[model samples]
Each structure stands twice: as structure tokens, then as C-alpha cells.
Target chain A: MKPAPFAYAKARSVEDAIALLAQHGEGAKLLAGGQSLIATLNMRLSAPRILIDLNGIAGLNSITLKGGEVEIGAMTRHAEIERSDVIRKHAPLIAMAMPHIAHPAIRNRGTIGGSIAFADPAAELPACLLALGGLVEIAGPKGKRTVKADDYFKGLYETAIGACDMLTGIRLPAAPAASRYGFAELSRRHGDYAVAGLAASATFASGKLTKVRLAFFGVDLTPVRAKAAEMALAGGDLDKAVAALASDLDPPDDIQENGAVKKHLAGVLLRRVVQQLTETRA
Target chain B: MNEMCDISLTVNGERVSERVEARKSLVDFLRDDLTLTGSHVGCEHGVCGACTVRVNGEIVRGCLMLAVQCDGASVETIEGVSDSGEIADLQEAFQKRNALQCGFCTPGMLLTAQDLLSNDQTPSRDHIREHISGNYCRCTGYHAIVDAVESVAQARKGSRK
Candidate 1:
């Protein structure tokens, strides 16, 4: 019930935070929202010699929609994203998936970059970002770099973010005018981690789908991009996409669900999301 | 050994300053240091909402947040919200509907339900249930709790009319 003790430092600026990270390396952990980090700390699953609290940095919590893209800072809370009209207007797919992350209390403190940086296989933000074709910005002792969503996530609880790097911002190309999205997940309880989840976004132009992207979470080592399904569903009906998932995915059994059941739920969610895209025509 | 931090904040409208360990949870700080025992500790990992409280006008899991993070922030616990008479009607509604059995989860439940009603003037039954999904109520089956919330909403609406 108690976390191992660690020294705490607050970063008033990005450079200061990165300096601390470089100094401590893997021995230090950045406290973003603390929704996920503190939980691991309390359970003794993670112990670090230093905690770099990023909340004191003033500019990292802004969400900007400009130049045909949406840029969300790393410290932006889930609750802020859920209620931001700018997010809803620019990237509705991410907005659609916000409530599924956790309840409002948790959302008020949990952060978007933290979720992506943690890279939980069961999380919704990672899959949603994958479906949005998002990019992650990283800052470290070597300075700044940008990684595409496809390259950002590495594996279970692992990311391209270096131990001495801090995820600074998430960037997404603006959803096209005709882009319609559907996000759904199967969890025993509403706010619990999903047993299986799906997020799909596509442009419906001239009664046909274009730029189709489907991402599934809680069914693999990382959020999976169903490219085969996307290819099959482009300019065609959703049943093809739903059926293609069977071939595209083969997740192993986990504590909450057997592999077969998870596959079934994933298929079910795909159908619902595709139906959603159809019912809510662009 | 843990590093100690000194933090100052307004709790229930009172400005208080204290020196706490860097690793001390907000819930433990309030309960042990300040003797504000209204908020309970159930699952310290932020799943269960038993330690819910308002920090800078938003409800958060107190157990998941460290006291040092709350420096200069405003926190409102169940004890504060109850004493402020802000949720008098909600407390009465809970009693009328028998929303609790053992009462261990009552305080957190009230604060959670209060948050829902404050944000929504008219939330559906499904919405109420959805909002409190994080708060675990081991007794009362949640039917009475939902009813109490629904009842308060209706009363507020009637009074508005």
C-alpha cells in the first residue's frame, strides 16, 4: 500500500525537466498526470530514485488547432480533451474515445501524453492516436525529434521515448471534412480497462470510403493497425473489413479474456464502428 | 528515506500549511495530518473512487496524487462540501432513499453524485450510473443511490420552475 520513497523535483521549464531526466536517466521517472504513474508507484511495480514532476511547467497543457493539424501538449488532462470543442471539431475520433479512458474523476487528472508514453496495450488513447495517424514529439539531452504514431509505440509498457526523453506534444493531421469516426470497447465495467476495443476513422467521399484506418487495443502487445482490414474496406462495405480482422489478428489469451473471445469481441466492435460510420454519413 | 516537502493549500476554505513527505498521498495527508477523516481509502491505486476529492474545482483520486502536487491548490473534501450546505439536498435524498447500508462508501458516493448533478441539470439514469462507475458501493445495490440522485434532480428542476 506504500510506495518506495524517492526524491521529488518540479520542472518549471522543459529544459529543466530534460536536464533532470538526462542526469538521472532510467533512475528517474516523470510524473505526468500521476493517474498511471502513481498507481504503479503505490503498488511497488515501479521504483525510481527521482521523480520529475512535469505539472509545474506552464506551457505544456495547451491544445492548439492550426495549419490543418491539431497539437496537444503532453500535460493536457483527459478531462480537458473530453470537453474541448476544438478537439471535437478537429479530431472527433479522439474526442469519441475520451470517455472510455476512465471515469470523470480519473479523467480530471489523467493525461493524454502520459497515456501514450506509458503505452499500455489496454489503453484507448494509443489506439485512437494510431487511427488518427498522429505523431509524437520528444525532447531530451539531444534536443527535439518527432516520431510518427506508427513508430512511436514499441511494445507492452514500452515506447520510443528514451529514458532521458520527455514526450512534449502529440500532433495529428486535421480530420478531413468528410471524416467520420466510431470508437467502441468491451469492458466488464464502463471505466475499467477494455477487454477489446476498436477505433476507426475514414473519409466518406461520393458514397465510398477513403483513407480508412482501423486500430485495435487490448488484443496485442501494442495497439495494432489493421492495414489488411483497411485495404479490404476501402471503397467497399464494412463487412469485408470485419471479416478481414479474423485474418489480420490473432491475439494470445490474457487474464480478462481468452484469445478466441477477445477476437470475437474485436470483430463485434469493428462491426459496430463500421455501422456507426455508415449510419452517421458524412 | 523519503524527502519531506512543505506544502500550503486551502482545504474546505481554510488556508493550512504543513510539512509532509514527498511520497505522502493527499488522502493520507488529509486523514493523518489534518485529521479530516471524511475521505476514506479503499483502493490506493486510483481505481476505486473512495478517496475522491476536488482539487482546483475538479474531482480527482486523492490517493493517486501526492500532497506536494497540491501546493497552493484548493481542495474540497466530503466534510467541506457537506458543511458548506452545498449538498444538503443530496444528503437528505440519500437518507430518504436509503442509499447506504454500512456507510463506508457514503461520503465518497455523495461527493461523486454531487459532482454529476452540478455538471448536469438533467442527467439520465444511465448517465448517473455511468458517472459513478468508478465509485464502488459494496452495499445498497446502487438502485437506491441512483434513485436518490434522480430525485434530487427532479426537485431542483421543480424549484427552478
Candidate 2:
């Protein structure tokens, strides 16, 4: 399968890319790492009239720490994040999830921004971002603005980014003193899309769990927070938390498995992650 | 008519210039234009690593990348690496171990295995399997391929010591 013919424009700057997006309007797609976009193009699932290549843009591939946040460039490759000492030290959850994104070959070219922008319900980054309370930086004709991860993901393959807005970068708060994280995904193969997954971040205070955020992916239209399960966990009722998943998740039947099976597997992952978080403290 | 872009890039250490359609994948350009058929195209998509190649020193799915994207980049295919003897030992090990049956997946497998050995010459059997998991081989069932890679790694390590 070959991609349909399209005009390509390499943008030298974010502004240049934004201008191209504005000019092409709905007929253009921004090429980040091209891992997902290119596949869709080859499958004839999507055919944009113009491709605005953002690879030539500088300053969009750096990882930096400012104040108490780890700011990662949208164009930063997954391989870079896997090796970044800053991410490992400051945002361990993102670091923990990097190797699971894809294979080494794909990781070398897949971008963090592209993953988040695509907002695939089965992708790990969006769920991790939700669990970390991260912020997505967006740039458009009106300039730049930040959207909370909770608000950033709109639905399956949808995000807060508009037609002409570019996802510039992501800012995640550095892990706090008592923060602990747990991440796991179940897939047929190591590199295949997950059937079900969970990314959890919580803090234990005075023998009580607080600020628990459990984001589940591949279980809904978007990476969703299991609010009821989170409350149950924070309140020290593990059994209730397990049962609360019923109220929290309603996964649709997908290619990998049925909704009930995915829900059961998700519960299994939740138990494992909860054990990981609690056992570390013990 | 498809739009074309003029690009100049180094393939297998030789500098060449060509005009390609904006949508032409790097694998197609190499096989159809440059006549470098070592890198086979299996799935045309990124799932099958049959189109794996090195771009700027990192292995990437050739089918997932546009040729125009490599205008100023350096690309190394199986032919380039094989001709230069870069993966000579790996190739010999594959042959000696009978790691391939159909040979369709050999080019991509060698490239992937070489990439792993280059990173960590002492990779464990599990690590080797994981590293090459992206590259699918329907013929050998992967046991022999893993054996071949492991043999080379051990040989390289022993020699280094």
C-alpha cells in the first residue's frame, strides 16, 4: 500500500508550520515523527492534500527542567526520553513507560508530541500524562497556551488541539517527595497495542493514601480517570476499589478482546500496580 | 500528477541525488530507484520490520519514512552494511546457524540483530528476542535466529576479553 500523492512542505519554525496549517486549513496534516500518520496514509485511511513536515524545525526536540517541572519538546523522540536522565530523575513514570511505546526502530522516530497529539485511546503516553497531571503546550495563530492533561484529551483520536494549532511541548510536574507510580499494559506482543493498561500515581500520607489518580487506557474513548476506583483506593478499601471499576469503566469491545475481558484484565493490572505501590512503602 | 521534490542524500556511503514523489516511501525509492534490494518491503506499513534501514545512524522503518525526509540524511541498508563488512560476523553466524529458511526476512533481521549487538554486545537471550521482536520471521520460528545472534555476541565478547 502506498500513500496518496501529496505536496510536502518542510517548516523551518513553529510559526512557519502554523502558517502552513492556516493556509491549508482542513486539507493539511502536520508531520511529526510520521510513525502513526504515515501508516494511516499508506493504508488509505487518511489522505491529506498537504503534509507540513515539522522535522526541520529546531528547538522542538529538547528536554529541559525549569523550576519544578520537566518540560519536554513535542518533537523529542521516545528513544531520547528512554535515555534522558532528567526524565528518569524528575518524571519517573514517563521514563518507566517509554520502553513500552514501541520497538527500538520505531522509538527512534516516534515523538512524544505526536503520541499525545494523536491521543490514541490505546496509547500509553496520554494515560501517563493524565496520571501525572501534566500540561500540553499548544501554539496557534493566537500564540501559545497550556491545557491540563485532564482537559487536553477529548476522545478517541481527538485532543484539545485545533485544526491550525500545533502541539508544541508537554510540561510535567517533577515528582514530589512522597510520590509513587505504577504502570503496566497487557498486549499480545511486547510492541503491539495494549488490550488494557493502567498508569497510577499516588502519595501515602500518615498511613493513608491521598491524591490517588488512576488513569486507564484501552478501556474507553479516551484515557480516563477511574474516579470511583481512585476514591476507594484513597480511602484504604482495596476490595472496594476493585469493585468500583464496574462503575468507573465501560470498555467497548475491541479487536483484541471483548469489553468484559478487557475490564477483567484491567482489574488484574490494577491489583498488580496497587501491590507495587504499597509494597514499595513496606 | 504527484508532486516531486529534488533530494540529495548519502546511501550506503555514496552520495546521490534524485527526484521523488512526496509520498514515495524510502524503501520503495531504494529498491525501485537505487536498485538496493537488500532491504525487502513486507507490509508497506510499520508493523513488519522488513523495511528496516538506518537513517542518521538509527534504525527506522523505511516504509514509514518519506524519501524526501532524507534529503540531507545518511541511510545505510543491508547492502551497504554487508558490502562494508560491518555485519559480516552476524551474517556468517546466521548462515552457520541456519537462522533463515525463506531468506525474505534475513536482511531486516540482520540489520536488527546488528543494531542490538552494536548497543550491547553482551545482550541476554531474552534481550535479543525482545530487541528483534519488531522484526517478524515466519520461517525459522525465531529460535535459530536468536541462537545465531547469541553466538555472535558470545564470540565478540570472548574476543574482547
TM-score of chain A of each: 0.97, 0.98
Encode model 2's per-residue lDDT on B21-56: one tens digit a residue: 999999999999999998999998788899999999
TM-score of each prediction = 0.97, 0.98
* Pairs with steric clashes in candidate 2: none
lDDT of each: 0.90, 0.93
Best by DockQ: 1
Model 1 ranges with Cα > 4 A deviation: A235-237, A280-282
* Among all candidates shown, the one with the greatest TM-score: 2
Candidate 2 lDDT, A1-282, residue by residue in tens: 998889999999999999999998998999999999999999999999999999999999999999999999999999999999999999999988887888999999999999999998999999999999999999999999999998988877889999999999999999998888899999988988899999999997677778999999999989999999999999899889999999999999988899999999888999998886676455
Candidate 2: where are CA atoms >4 Å away? Answer: none
Ten-residue stretch with the least lDDT total in model 2 chain A: A273-282
Task: Kindly state the fnat score of candidate 1.
Answer: 0.74
